[model samples]
Target: MSNEAYAQQCNVRELMREDANSEVFFQKYTLSEETAARLESIREMLKDDIAQANPLWKVIAGENEEEVYSESETSNNDDESNHNESQMMHDQLVVPSTQFYFTQTERTFVETSDTSAALPQRCDILESACESLERNNGRLDFVQLENLSNEDLIPVVDEMAGKLSLKGIYNLCASMNNMTIEQKIKYLNVLCTHLLLPKIIELEEPSRLLSSAIVECVKNFPDEIQQFIFVPLLNAELKDTMLITTIINSFDLEKKAILLEEFLAYVKELKSWHISILQNFLSVRLDHNMTDKITKLFSGKALYYSKDKTFGKLILSFLKLNTALSQEQKNLMVEVVAVNETLFKRPMENILKNM
Candidate 1:
């Protein structure tokens, strides 16, 4: 054999010995049955080529050692290129199966559905609501009305107030401003009617919106309507202090005095808190002539100082506001202070000093 071929044969034997000893080398070049069969065919072809070239290489090496070295280097380059191409083909075949397995598994693992289905249109929703409102004669149940816009509720208020005589429209009035004064007066009239009187009387607490709407109606309409609305409220079995205060405060001095006189008859039945509200009403008064009536209203009565101190203070403060105090009023102040000296001490001193 030629020297170059002898060296190549020795190198191949060394590589096969290394592959036999190393598990990684063996695994790296291991092939499937089909690939192993194809490799065997290629090995046979290589063996034939080597066998044919051996004699020729020996002749060349004997003539020129440089030619043998060049030929051996060219053979090595070609073998390396063929090995890389085989590795690339093996990678291309193995990678696609791995990628396909993962892609199929991922598709099977996830759930998906079409999410672009249509929803009910806005106009359709409004039309349904309007039809429901009309069926109920524009007086929707409170639950039904809760989801409606204010504009949609306006017609409901008109229909309920005009036809059904329902006072629930007042609850909706806070969000509505399109209601006319006449419409509100009609609602207030319904509120004051004998039919609705029981509902108004049963209310343990007054609605502020309903009370304000009543006041608005009273202000915009005539005094007869005020009397018509207020008298029933005052007589209602469930008396709300805030509602009473609103009604009393809405009246002129003469009307307020008349109400005060009527309230005084029930003073014995009034709560301390109610008395405090009366004190607030009296405290804001600008009339001095009404002082004697207020003083006499509380005079000669065994009033509880702890409970009635606010009213006491209001009376003394009202008296002190006067430029001059009468001898009877001074005596009355002395009597009131004697009853609750501790509570009335500061206001009493101020009044005495002013006198």
Candidate 2:
């Protein structure tokens, strides 16, 4: 063979190796059925020519082409099997458990303003109330608990963390209409600062239950309490995205805009999975102005994590939503998609055509 022919053969072999091993090729770039079949046919036609021109053939398999072919076939099959196995393992590993879990700490004493003589009496009553709750398996004796003033109930609420399950808390809150709105907010604040936020974890189940109970209990409260309590909850260290998302769904469009405004500031640090959930939740009800704001925020940050598959998936979902997008927003999506065409091509094409 001429030097040019040998170099061309080497180039083809390197391209084939890249097709098999490049991460982008293996993951993001998928061949269509027809294209795959055509490539296979081309490979067969070149098999004899490749064996003849290849320099390593004699050193690797000298006059035993069938053995060489079989070994190559086995290696290709192993690559495919390993890829499938890894994909299955990934799917299994990421399946989050539905059980609620949280770390516990010893109860801290909350100060009360009772006189020294009355303090001991309050302590005895608090101890008895806690023991009663423990014996009753976290069920509230509303008649018993109702007789306690708000100051006395605060510590009891703090102690109910591991003792009282969400169902019990929901039931307790559901029966609290008799309390004035201010009193209810005061009580709910303890439930939040003492019970909910302290026990919150990064898992879904605990946050889901806690968020549901909170929304159910306060859904009928005055807007002032929701604004005061719910907005700050969005910034908790282990932020409960489920809670924020649920609150967004439960409120009116105006309330959602307010929540989303707060979310906009925090979303810069949100996990990609959390972003996906927010994408799904926001798709249903975001107004045009809020939608545009979100699009701009995500678009501005899109190119920074452009290679992240989860972030890319989020970009795709955002593009596919039925909400209105400005020309500038659409341009930003196009720019990010261009940066990662392997992952974003088909979806981006569909989005552009629709737009």
Give the number of the best model, judged by lDDT: 2
TM-score of each: 0.40, 0.50
lDDT string, candidate 1, 143-233, tens digits: 4444445454545443343432224435333212344565444444433453233444545676775577556645655354445544555
lDDT of predicted model 1: 0.55
- lDDT tens per residue, model 2, 211-259: 6655765566636335555555555554445655565677776666665
Inter-residue clash pairs, candidate 1: none
Steric clash count of candidate 2: 0
Identify the runs in model 2 with alpha carbons over 4 angstroms from their true place: 1-115, 120-125, 132-172, 175-178, 201-212, 222-225, 237-244, 252-255, 265-268, 284-289, 303-310, 322-324, 340-344
TM-score of predicted structure 2: 0.50
